[model samples]
Target: MSRNELVRICRSNSIESYLQDSKDVQYCSRDKPLIQFFKLNTNAAIDGDTDGLGGIIRDSSGKEFAAFSVKLPAEAIHVLEMKAILLGARLAAEKGLTYTLLESDSLTAVNVISEVWTCPWKAIPVLADIRDALFCLNNWKLSHVWREANTAADFLSKPTCCIKRVDIPVVDLPIDLLDIIVADSNGTIYPRL
Candidate 1:
């Protein structure tokens, strides 16, 4: 083959490889945390005029420990995402949990908290508070998960568009939420799209 043709083929292959590596995730599952740690997953959303923040904490066995949902004036969804995480961390601390695994469906918020991406100015205050809350934990790790695996938290934080049932205790959780919890505990895998 001619030198120029070989160079062109190599560049095409390089571009294809880059695209493959950057491909969006195709599946997600809610993995249980380490034996001694609790996993907290949180999600947030903005309705026309209201923002809903929610989070759920589950033990290594995937049993629910605590969950919360709060409503407030509408803020950017990105900011609300951080607020949800902050609330989750605080809840774990309140429950005297030392080791924790925090998860969020907002990849942007998770990237910011992990310092993998730049922080938007509006979210800085909430991010600062999140850092403080995380600092209280003796051991912790934070990462992003796909929304499908975050079904329970997503249901909890959806805007006023949907009526979220009562608080998320094992007995009081809405049937739908309970079903999601059970699926997660059973290690059901969810498709990304």
Candidate 2:
């Protein structure tokens, strides 16, 4: 199928409706000649609370290909969430991806990103950057997700400073905080997701 035809189909149909049999479709690598899609997730840790974000890029298969996270002070989490979106956009552009989805768990953040929240502040600059980067892509979508469904990115934002340092390069944070986050993450029993 031609690129324009595929894009038209994507715009008209749900991703699952387009690609029901993912096993039959060819999966492209970073080096292969293929259309690239990007998904990015981010979370910011402020004080004792956290704000999570999740972004997805539905290419032919509609799976997440690239994602990331960011942690910051609770009071500054909103600013950091905007920054994460900017960073995710930059990453997508760097990969030469033409389709992108930017998602966040914070409704406020998503609103600002989607231009539903009109007040502009410190985030105006980066949000503008995200806006500009988004224009470069042929297709894009921004969405909000509940924190429970976005675990891998949440894991990346765990409070590291509070954790005790082990031989590993990264320190594990306080057990109590870890327990709470782990429990919040889908209630799954995986030691680590």
Candidate 3:
């Protein structure tokens, strides 16, 4: 098929439809996979104090793709939020994914990410970077989810463990929070390679 046809098919297909079809393909490549696999399902949440931003990224298959929590001074919550969004976007781009839908528990943050209104001064540059990153992907969206539904991101955002990249089995509680459990159980916390 022609490239135009491929683009049309991608543009017309939804994430669920694409994932259903991916199973039949032998080896998926980046060429059209981002259009297919990149669901852009994101959720970000901040506490009342706004000291940190927590979020998640899932591909089309509903898999736990990426999770992050970034900490900031209470005074710099807005700026840090933009940075967090940008960081998420950058990670998505590096992974050759597109068509992301960013979600935030904070309506204010959602608006800023979506450009529904002006971002605060300290946030403008980071917001600009997020816009540029999404533009490169050719598709992105932002929405808000309730806090309860955003637990995955919230867990990731907690101030506990050091940051590293690897596939981790889902845990009921975040590792940082689990430290308390470990201490009580008198078990050592081991790092996994």
Candidate 4:
């Protein structure tokens, strides 16, 4: 089925309906390509006067592809988290990724984007932009992860970290986050409260 048809079906019925209907479609064939996976996190300083947003994208084999971080003007933590998700989606779109799975450590942010929870007034615009970005993709998923499992993004999102506003290709992982990245790639689980 064409991507537009799939999107139309998803909008008319539901994701489950579209999946069930498209089981025999060519795009959903056995040789389907691997989906891109990305982890996103955001942090606000002690005074909530400055926020940092970060995200890391990886291929199916767990190899990092791209990473990005940006400092934003003062905002609520939830707003910052939502902004991080928006940035991730925009970056994926810019890179022309057709399929992606975005992970965020903030359950609230994930829920808001998935429409499982209502978005705050301050975050509606950002959430709308994220939705638009997702709609442009052939396939995408958004889910929540434990902060422990998302340490690389968490570290990048630290207010004190010296990350540029532009997206960075992950050719050489930052020395500071090498250990955490290795642990994540090795499937080392960390306890989360």
Index of the highest-TM-score prediction: 1
- RMSD from true fold, candidate 4: 13.4
**RMSD over all Cα atoms, model 3:** 14.8
All candidates: TM-score: 0.81, 0.53, 0.58, 0.74
Q: Residue 151 of candidate 2: its Cα lDDT?
A: 48
Cα-based RMSD of candidate 2: 12.9
Minimum summed lDDT over a 10-residue window in model 4 is located at 24-33
Q: For residues 1-193, write the lDDT of model 1, one tens digit per residue.
A: 4434433443532443433454452545799988999999999987789889988888898888888788879888899999999999998888889999999999999999999999999999999999999999999999988888898888778764244323345456667777778889977655455
List the lowest-lDDT window of 10 residues for candidate 3. 184-193
Ordering by lDDT? 1, 4, 3, 2
Backbone collision tally, model 1: 0
TM-score of 1: 0.81
Instruction: Show where candidate 3 strays beyond 4 Å.
Output: 1-51, 72-74, 167-193
Candidate 3, residues 1-193: lDDT per residue as tens digits? Answer: 4434444444532333443455442211111114355433233334556455555566554455565556655656566556666767776777666667665556776787767877888877777788788776666666665543444455555544244332335344456534422331232221111
For model 4, residues 11-37, the per-residue Cα lDDT tens digits are: 532354445555453322101126444
Quote the lDDT for 125 in model 2: 79
- Give Cα-based local distance difference scores for all models: 0.81, 0.52, 0.52, 0.67
Off by over 4 Å in 1: 1-25, 160-170
